[model samples]
Target: MLRITATATISLTVGAILATAGFLWADRAFPPPLPARLEASTEVLDRDGLLLRAFATPQGRWRLRTDLASVDPKLIEMLITYEDKRFRQHRGVDAFAILRAGWQLVSNGRIVSGGSTVSMQLARLMEPRDARSLGAKFRQIFRALQLERRLTKDEILTRYLTLAPYGGNLEGVRAAALAYFGKEPKRLSVSETALLVALPQLPERRRPDRNVEGARAARDRVLNRMVSAGLLSEREAARAAAEAIPERRLALPAYAPHLAETALRNAPSATAHRLTISRPVQSGLEAVALNAATRLGPKLSVAMVMADARTGEILGSVGSADFFSTGRAGWIDMTRIVRSPGSTLKPFIYGLAMEQGLVAQETLVEDRPSDFSGYRPRNFDMRYQGDVSVRQALQMSLNVPAITLLDAVGPARLAARFRRAGVMPQLPPGESPGLAIGLGGVGLSLRDLVQLYTGLADGGRAHLLRDGTELIEPSTASTDVLEPQAAWQIADILSGVKPPHGATQRGIAYKTGTSYGYRDAWSIGFDGRHVLGVWVGRADGGAVAGLAGYVAAAPILFEAFARSGLALQPMRRPPAGAIRARRADLPVTLARFAPGADGLTAAPNAPSEPPPQIIFPPAGAHIDLAEGTAAPLAMKLQGGRAPFRWLANGKAIAGLHRTRTATWQPDGAGYSTLTVVDAAGRAASVSIFVE
Candidate 1:
């Protein structure tokens, strides 16, 4: 009988050994399930790892990446003390805690405390169970064992911290901390840490957004447990429990939304993307844009881009005034939209002219009524400054002189120069190069404008803007769009231009432009360190009356610089060949621009074009004057020739010269016949009675 029993025991032991070997072999042969913890929420962060934007995970939860190093260490201590006291010593499950729980259940005839370790909880979170049954518990045990064999203690703890539930759609400690305290998890108060440690246990029941009283109770429980475990003094626990609980969730940081979206799309496989944006600067500029757009008219939008000129890194980009407003079509990124740049390109024309030694700052240029072929360019105010210095003409943005210089430099060459600097201005389809391009005839986005201006800021060398990618070294080749001397000259000229009120002391070189028909307004400027561009107008191509760049956009530009938090570096010193001398000191060839020299007038002995016709206040019409003595009647003309002369009631208007529009002050209650005659003696007449 003894021999038979020994044989049976040996057989049973061998069978158990075989089963153990089979299980071990299976664990080695088959791969464990890929942890759901790996599917982290995609995030867009600033240069310092501060959240700029975050996207929901594929499961529609906020499961951000979290580890022990990033989390508050106090919270970790509280978590282990409350959840699993023997967590470090146990392999996967706490045998002592399980036995204690079973003993309490049997003695009390009901369940008391759960014995699952932190590892077991993580396993359940990774592979969720539909039912709370013995089968689910067994599955969790198996997963816990697998995790213990595959991961380190910190790894298991990090998975718990990241995957633990913290109320609706929030599945991580960092998300909980941010949602509750509106800050990061790296720094937390005792009360906040206690609440965070308790939420994952019964997240839905104690969600602060939905159940404030329950949340407070749960937090107090954590504090009490902490005191009992000797981790916290009773007085400290009581003080912590008295802290207020957040009743509402807070929104995550949403700066640089367009940039965040672009980065995410560019790197779709990445779980997180780090940008070069500065959070403080970005936030401040976003506020500036929002406030500016509100002050501007309805249906109008604002877009701004600011970059580091020295490194060519895009620091801040406000894609639009509002990203969620459908009324303004704010979802469209205006920074990338191509529209007429207006007079913004004028500086480049002067810069190119300077590079060719064709003009100096003090060179005399005629701003009188001029025409190149059929393209008659006039100043913005439709009046001439007549023979002003090049600096004055450029500062006042006189169109005639700019076009003349562009005529000398050739528009094709200017276009090619910009292309070489990584800015491609879009001309009208099938249109040949013309002098009108010097007067806002071509198309460009704010981004392109910033690129060109940054070149001037970088001493004539243009570097491509960095978009959170690898840094590209600037080239020192002759491929620079402008020579150092020319760039310094342009920068100096712009720095002398007047700033908007309340911003006169800012040492920035800025230029403003109003597109034809008031469709687009632009303000582009740069200091020694940074380049900024602003655009304001309707999203759809429609004219907004009284929309001029200086009035609509320049204010925002100045305000952006003031709020950008970057110290304005002084512009570089003038390079060789950059002179600030008077007109007489310039070379004779560059001192004075002759009439026909720039193709701005009819060739000598050429046939004269017809004189202009007065189109407004038609002949024999009676008119009642509007209120206000300053309200001069607007006189318009058509088919004008060079230097068209205007006469109201046979008196030549003093400031009237070659242009389409002329404002004439009417004598009170009189008959008036307005006649405009060209320099070539071609004339037309309009008569009206003023009441």
Candidate 2:
């Protein structure tokens, strides 16, 4: 009897070894057809990892990649407790759960619960099957064992989270949370966690958006299970069950659509693209752009961009007011489309002049009807402010003055400066930079103009703007657009200009431009840290009558700054040698801008006379005025023809005097420019400071 019992034990052990060997051979011969790779939707995330935009997979499914850490801990705990209590201990299938299910089925004459572990569910998700019979269950068990051996516990969990269906084309917890709750899964309330945990079972039937009652019931079941498992208290379970389920799914985040598309094109194979955008700022600016476009007209589109001046990082960009609107041709990215830039290029012209020491803020410059080699340039109003100060010309955006300065500085030089800053203005096929280039004659994109303005904001240093598409690290290399002092001077003048009507003053340096025929309107503004550019126009290049930049785009620019949710960074302090001196305080040669030989045309057969020269209040002189009183300074000049026009800082004295000597009341000055223009148009000037 002992020998027979020993023989039976040996036979059982041999059978057990043979069964294990067979199982291993089957596993290797028919390895579960696990996918080599999972396809996930492409996502564009902001700097803080907030979703900015997401593109659907080729199969039209929303399968966002899921990370275990990004999901709420409560959801995981509740899911494990309700779905598979022995999930951690089991390799693939839970023996105790299978036995309990079998006993319940036999006693109740029906299947009461599933014996499948989380690993089994993940296997089924990876390789779907239509059959619900014993054969399908065996297949799932086999595949689950293979997955367990090949992947870690966390890896299996994450794959399950990523592939689990949640109604419609939404696959994965991240997509489900974003659709139902309009937020990420990183932070969810107890009620939200319960809903997400229960959705994978009968996803379509329990979808909250389709059947709120069914979803609520499923969520309540999850909460109850959590309580039974001691994962949650009864009171907590009840509170969670009482919460309302979302009746409608919200749309996913879709900000910066144009920029998102650009990123996708630049990196076609990347599953996730991270950008420097701030979601809140992008949302606010987009709203502002849409509202402005709607108010302007049905055919007009609006575009905007806001960036860090020092770093050149784009914080927000709106390619169009509405990406789906047909009337405005919203599909076009207006920010990158080349269009006439109007007077937006004027600031750079003046900046170059200042850097070259050709003009000062108070330098008198003629703004009359003029012809540059038969190419006549006129102000927007078809009227001119004769003999205006350089500061007034720029603040008023006078076309004649800008052209005159551009001519003196040479349009080619201005274009070179723009190119140095990584912006190339589009010109006519055969035309070089001409006087018209100063007044909307050249084509440029809104982005190009903003890049140029960054120099002014960052003390003459211009950085290359980026939206994170480049593989290399952000570069600190910058191009010099102007000297520090010259840039500061431009910023100071722009900051002093009044804001558009009905807009609050923001203390930002801004310039506005109107293209010829009123086809385009532009406004660019900046503080010390950030720069924002706005463009308003018909996408078809049709003119919108009376659509001037100040009236159309400036208001929107101001509104964008206000809505951007960022505090207005103060303008930088003036650099060394950067001082705002009155016209009279300028050097004798700089007191009045004398155009080059090419810019000036001598009067026909006019008598030549010695140029007028200031005698009293000599150049760079300082005089003390009586306190609390309007004190007049005696000014005198010699030579030149008379019926002389005495001017202080470009404004004519009350009346023309035949006598050279004249008395003028100082405008409570710190610095002043006194000038006299002779009958022959010859002029002399002096700068003085009055205490």
Candidate 3:
């Protein structure tokens, strides 16, 4: 009998050893697949990892990417304590939990509590079944055991946090936090963390948006469980439980919508895209554009782009006034669309002329009417200031003076210079470059305009704007758009221009441009560190009345600069070669600009004699004048030149002629005089009073 018993014991021990070895081999060979929930929605983030935009996943759900480190520590502690107390001790499945579950089922004649560990719950979420049956539970247990052999504790938790559904279309803790609290998971308060940790157990039944009372109850249950498990103090748990439940879901951050689309195009396969944009700056500029658009009336769109001048990093871009307003064609990204640039190119023409020694800031240039190959360019106001200093002519945006320079600088050469600056303006089809290009003849985009201005800020060197993704580092190859002296001279001239109404002096060099027929208006400006451009107009190329750049766009530009929260750094000082002397102090050839008979390059010499001078209404002459019964006064001139600028008091007298005499009509009885400035910078003024 003893021998027989020994034999049976040996057989039983051998069978047990074989069974154990088989199980170990199976665990090593066929571990559970880490849930195949890899399809995540594309997320666009700002420079600091702040969410800028998010898209729905292929399955029409918001399953944002999440990890253990990105969640609040308090939330993770509560989650593990309430869901799986032995999560750290067990490999995956807890035998004690399964036994307790079975005992409860047997005692109640039905399933009462799920005694499922977090890992098992994760497995069920990975391979979700329609019905909660015994078969599904068994499968979850098997998958959990397999997962234990393949992943670490942290890895399992991350999978659960990422895949767990949190009601409706929202999945994952990050998505839940953003939807319920309008904040990131990492910034959750104690109450917020408890609510987030409680959602996945019964998402639909406890969804705060759908059932506030149910959500509160579930959150309280979590708090009570945490207290019982010693994970939280009773007082703290009660306080958290008392916190109000969120009753509504919030939309995610949606700034830089167009930029987000661009990012997706740049990296279509990426699950998350990071851009070089500042959240605060972008948000502020969006508001600026929207408010400006509303005030500018219907069908008017506003676009802006701001960048780091030195590094060429695009900081913010507002594609349109409102992304959803069809009335303004807001769907179109105005920053990228080409439109006539008006007088924006005049500054570059002046810069080129300065670089070539063709003109100096104070050098006198004729602003009178002139014809260049039948071009006959006229000023915006249809009146001339005669011979004005280059500085005044540029500040006033005199078209005749700009065309004269462009005629001398050759449109082809200007186009080449623009190419060197890393942008190519679009000339009208079937047309060669011409003087018209200097004044709104060519098409350019807001981005291109901003880039050129940034080049000026960088001392004439043009750099490619950085996209913030770092997928492609900025190139070292830079183009010299202008000489340092020329850039400084242009910046100096523009900086002195008067700011638009309601704007403070910001020490910024800026220029405004109005396209033909009021189709496009632009304001491009820069200080030492940043460059910004603003464009306002209709997207369909239709003209909008009263769309002058100085009045419409400059105000928006100044407001944007103020809202950006960036320091107003002063522009670079004049370089060594820059000239700072008066017209008379300059070299004889550079002192005065007298266009040649051909109406192109500077003449060989200034006129031999001074320009004609007015000699009428001798000093302090008072003549009887009335508003309705005022006789036209005859103004006489002495030797100088014709087509002179005759100002009655401080207003211009219309029409240009070589006649030695001119007529003026007084508006009312007041102190007034006739002041004439000839084409040679020679001026004579007489004081008179109308009684």
Candidate 4:
């Protein structure tokens, strides 16, 4: 009777407990309450709507972003297949995936599979920019749910593919495609597509440059998965596995470093939409920098910037070594930093002074040593040339007179003008003293200096480079910033500026600058279309020193200008009205001409006989020929014994050996003038246009 009574009670208790448990289980819910709303930092792009770069904050670095449509599809497929096979079917986190993950946790020794959906991963990647935490993970999941509700599966896929990091500073598939195959993602072959897919799994380790074999193996493994998933055929998978991948990407920068330097600053502005930086011009500039650096050898580094004066578009820029060289980390954009501008700053000060009526074009100024508040400035040679006119001082970059002009203009106002012109530099309390400002001891970016010069070229008006294509809307700057007449006068001076007698006939309007102790060498010159700023020195970086300070660096500047298509705009030429011809002016006195005539290598002591006459294409040349077609525009003269010499583009012709006839051959795609100097030193000239 007692045992029956105890068993009945126990059974009753068990039944009651079971009923309560069932009710509790039915009432319980998953994924508790929601948290507060979260916001993400938005990335800004170039005028073309291309992402310029992103940073954690203002203090952080400007990180470059790769384009979308650049990544391989295989990578996208791999993540979806491995982590969430039913991602397309689920709203956000699949219930089945979660259930499977639970089973995996119990059955497997490690958390091998994640139930987290693609949307969840993207949410985390975009926000907090932080490491994984339980709370953070939950927040990510919540955002994923919101995203799933907001966007379609296709949109989610597109967003994920575009924003995902594939490795090597690449932000999207489009960038990966360009980096790996130098092509667009749509053009990727199955094998190449598979390789890019594998990189994101372990970016640092699988970087193609580091572990080509490992990346390939990972790619093959992913291909197996893709094939099994029926995205690609088994035959396709096999072919991809067997194929060799080209493991290289040319870091072809879309904007020249200088252009980037100029445009990036104004990205936050409303006008950030009109700037148009040309891709090919930028590539050519980069190519020049790289080739120059390589040809000079690794010990020397080069930074070059080329730009259009009218539009303010930087065509090419390079900060570090050439892209073709190995082991270069392009973290530092060389075209931005404001090095001591050297003599490069002189022209602007001269122009400003000229504009302010502080000095006129031909006003006599002293190039000899001068003092300001006990601070005296010396030329690069640390010596002085006696009294020089205002034009000569600027043309020769005469240091003492520049200081005198700066003293006259007052550094504070000039500094203000510099700021207005977009030059970013620390100006000494203008009230203090020195000629260093004129000498470019004032640090300013390459872009700022270029802009300053462009304004001078454009008739003393400054314009900011807005971000996009609306170039016609350049914000107007100070009017008459430079007097048109004075600026013209400076231009004339520079055209004829050089050494003892005259300047080189290249006729480029240029300025050579050297900072204190020769730490920097810069040459700023212009043709009608563009103004080129050439800075030569170290990139891994060091002060411009020794030979690099002078001979080595100066030639590079002149060479680049010569090679580029800068024309020496004719300054209001000297009136031929003041001159008359002497009957004897044709003879011995021809060689007795005054200094400053560019490219006048020789003059006849006297014509022993009738001079040579050009046989082909005549003087004002305009003709076309396929490359390497030799057309020696010959000359026939009475005296054959005179050594035949020729000049092309103001330099000596490569192959000339006394023969009376001179060949006017086309070298590159351009026009050149030929100067004929005979054995008797008699000279004649001709111009040829060749295509």
Candidate 5:
């Protein structure tokens, strides 16, 4: 009998050893397929780390990247207490819990509570199983043991937090929180914690949007379990249970849609992109664009961009009034679309001329009908201000004067300057730069125009605009767009332009432009620190009747500045050698802009009478007129036919006089123009500032 018992014991021990070796070999050979690398939605964030937009995962799941540090501690505690009581102490499986579950199942003749630890649940999530048989349970146990051996307690928990489902197409705690509570999972109330902890058990069935009562019951059960486990007090649990569950999921944040898309395209492999945009500024500008577009009637779209002149960082960029609107072709990014930029290019033309010492702010330039070779530019009003100071012509956006300057400066030189500023205006193929370019003949985007103006705002150094996503680092390299004095002169003239009707003047120096046929309307402005550009038109390049830049875009520009949530920075003080002088104060050559020999000249064969020339308070002079008192200014002229008519700023100062001198009372303390025209049509003008 002893020999028989010994043989049985030896056989049993041998069998047990073989069984253990087989289990170990199977666990190693068929290890659970842990996700090689979890995929999460890519996010586009603003400078402040706020979400601008998010793209779904390849599987079309809203699985936001999450970690233990970003989750609420209370939610973690409640989750462990409710899902797996022995979660902290267990290596993979809880033997005592398993035994208790078995005993309860046997006694009750049905399944009781689950004995799976959090690690086991994580293993099951990694390698999902459809069957609930003994074999699947044993496989889960083996996978759980493998996971505990390879991962730490925190790693296991974090993976579970990320992979656990909360509802249809929503995975991970961050996504769940954003959808249900409309916020991040960084802070959660007792009610919110309970709801999040309970959703993972049966996400689909307990989805609050589909079955509110079921979700509420599950949440209450979690609260009760937490109370029993000492994680929450009875009163706190009762209060949490009384809270209502969200009946529907909320949409995630979506801002700067066009910019976000551009960022993604620039960095297709990056999981998160950070741009130099301000969320508040973007939000405000978007609202302004939408409301403006709605009021402007159908098919009209608006695009805007605001940037920091000092750093070239794009603060706000609105591609269209609405990205989803079908009528406006909203998906097109109008800020980058090349279109005819009307009088917008005039400032740059004038700037180049001033830099070359061709004209001064007060110098006279003829705005009468004149042919530039073959191109004859006309005023927007189709009328002429025959003889006007350079300042008056620019402020009025007169085309004739601008074309004359362009002709003298040479169109190719102007195009070269644009290239230096990193903007290349599109000219017709095989065609060289022409005088017509001065009057919206070249193609440029709103962004191109804004970039050029950045030089005017930042003392002649044009900063390269960036929205992050460039492979190369931001360059500190400065491109000279204009001389400091010239830029300052341009800014001064633009600032004096009156704001559009009903728009408040915010001390911004701005220029307005209207493309030929009224196809595009543009307004670009700058303060001491910021520059903003606005475009209004149809995306298809179709003309819109009555679309004058001053009437259509100037108001929007002012409104954008007001709603941009930025303080109005004052313009910079004039640089050295930059001064506003009357024509009398200017040099004899610069006293009047003579478009050179290549430009407009006296009619061929017309007998010449010496032109009327202002001689007193000579061009660019400053006179002291007593303040708050009527003080007459003494003016004189020479070499003109008798019966000369005098004018001040386009208004008649006195009737034709044979005498070369006259006196006129000043109206205000500022710059004024004095002109004398002879009976033979010869004219001479001087610019004077009254103190």
Candidate 6:
């Protein structure tokens, strides 16, 4: 009985001791590894499921994974050499190497070289951030062992290769290859492979172009290790060592980084989807912008953006390189940042008014001067253009006339116009009067402005804008913004402006804007296919007062549009309204202008064909009906070969001024005929068939 009892106590004590050791092992090992998040809802596409951009998501981060076969072998070889020598031969953990590592720890006193295997390194890389504890480590060890038992050696290596970061902002060999060499992983050469292979250890430092010497040394070490391990023969290492290394040209690292970063931010699942950004377009645009900025002089910081006009998805954007695009992360993303729109907004304002039924394309309004809520805006040149057609004022970019139209259309209504175009333009926060509308005090992103202008290019229809093709859907949701007549009217006006045609940008009808003191210079135009917007001037928000719209913004717009294949066409003019007939009896440059009231302007001998006029506002709205008035009104007129005279209510108003009002008494009351004749003999007249 005594012998049996002693044996039972011994067994208990042995079990207890074993339990303690197990506890200690658990303590030493850590938690389960966390894999880097691979998918971003905003950036990933089904077509590009293997290439995801990262973002915070509920289902955990997913690393975009491509076929292991697609990865460059040099990259695989690099990770294998740096991480584990006997990766193919080991189980989840290499016991012999573990012993050696234990000995090294005993002698050297810290966890340093040659401890973890490739599987271990990959384990650390993939481990969840929250699960990085000793107990979790042990748990992960078991999981990895399970992985080893279930999966082939090649599968483990493949996962490790796909999940590794190569350099810079690139998280995978595929991204790194394109980021560095602007090519695909399958196309990488030996020297290129070596450079890429050496990058995983320290992506920033090992960039061959930036630190070629360090990269070469790191690569040589990798090759020597491979040789020592008999993975490759001496002849192979010799040839690799002798290969020519290309000198790295330091392309600006921050080149449109803000653009991409903003895109990723706006695209929620971008990080997870491993967003397949068009590196070529990004790189090419940077180059194009750089040349433009340099030629235009550094005093100008240019922003050029190209988007998928059909869907409003910004394919690529180039903000100012002077700050973000040239170097590293900064405080601002200028592309998305807002600025005043200046004259570039006129087409939309008029286009919307025309579309909304607030005004017709043939609607005649004085372009001379506008008096509204204590504001009278002058043209850019500070001159009154007098009696001009809606088309004439737009083509001339007459500031006063645009303000008049805005007053008539109502600022609140204009704000609504911006929203309908897929642009939440920053208007005056609260409802005020007309103070901010015509002055351009409202802030708007270049992105928003680009989207807003799309309505014009799309011929009165609007679509929900997207960031990429993935976000687009087949929809009949398109709504009309303007009558085809009104849309064409504004488009023609923008295209017909003087010498440098300050308005038209791309081969498509375009418009230019100059903010106060030339703080911003802009050119936006479209051809048959593309819409392009170019912004130039100071990023510092300093005055570009002396700078003209033609200087940089317009030229760059033209150049980029040409390069991108937006062909210019003979623009279709606005709807017919006032007509001027070239009569043999009048001055050679003189012609007759006649209003199309009840089809009068179309009559023969009226001289020139009816001049384009506001037919219908693109948007589907109309203002309250106003009875025809015979009140004689004084006016100034523009758009003929020269300036013209005015007769209102069937009476001349050339020198008529009385009280706060200057009146032109035409022949009768209610609505009467008004007419104007220019020095060059072009005449413009409208009939008010009174109620």
Return the TM-score for each candidate structure.
0.80, 0.85, 0.82, 0.48, 0.79, 0.57
Task: lDDT for model 2, please.
Answer: 0.86
Question: lDDT per residue, candidate 3, 1-691, as tens digits?
Answer: 9999999999999999997687678767766666455677799988888888999988899988888889988888889887898999997788988899899999999987777998899889888889988899877877888787778888888888988999999999999999999988899988899888889989999999999999998888888888888888999988887789999999878889888887887778888888888888898899999999999987999999999888778889899999889999888899999999999989889887665556778878989888887899999999999888889989999999999888876788888888887788897678888889999889889989888887789788877766565557768466778766678788889999999998999988899999999999999999988999999999898998889999999999999999998889978865533446676555444567766653333333466665555677666688775556647877888876555656553344675546778888776554454666555544465656667
Model 1 per-residue lDDT at 597: 46
List the pairs of residues colliding in candidate 5.
582-620, 583-619, 583-620, 584-618, 584-619, 584-620, 585-619, 585-620, 585-621
Once fitted onto the true fold, the runs of candidate 4 whose alpha carbons sit more than 4 angstroms away are 1-151, 159-187, 196-243, 246-308, 311-342, 348-448, 464-479, 485-508, 534-691
**Residue range with the least summed lDDT across 10 consecutive positions in model 2:** 598-607
- The number of the candidate with the highest TM-score is 2
lDDT per model vs. reference: 0.82, 0.86, 0.82, 0.57, 0.85, 0.57
lDDT of 6 by residue, 298-400 (tens): 5667777766555655544676744533332223555566888787777766765443333333345566655565776877888886666566778778887
Q: TM-score: which is higher, 1 or 5?
A: 1
Scored against the true structure, residue 204 in model 2 reaches a CA lDDT of: 96
lDDT of 4 at 690: 53
What value does the lDDT take at residue 267 in candidate 5? 84
Per-residue CA lDDT of candidate 4, range 212-249, in tens? 88778778887888888888888878988898766765
Minimum summed lDDT over a 10-residue window in model 1 is located at: 598-607
Identify the candidate with maximal lDDT.
2
Q: Considering only N, C-alpha and C atoms within 3 Å, which residue pairs clash in candidate 2? A: 583-673, 584-672, 584-673, 584-687, 584-688, 585-687
lDDT of 2 by residue, 1-691 (tens): 9999999999999999998788789889988766656889999999898889999999999999888899988788788888888888989999999999999999999989889999999989988888788998998998899888888888888889999999999999999999999888987889999999899989999999999999999998888888878988999988888888999988888999988988899899998899999999999999999999889889999999899999889899899999999999988999899999988888888987776556779988998988888988888888888899988999999988888888877999999999999988898899888888888888899988888899999988998888886667667689989767678888998998899999989988999999888999999999889999999999999999899999999999999999999999999987534678887766554677767553322333354667678889898788888787655778888887777877665355677789989998876545555677666555666656677
Off by over 4 Å in 5: 1-24, 103-112, 187-189, 227-244, 263-267, 386-388, 471-476, 582-590, 598-691
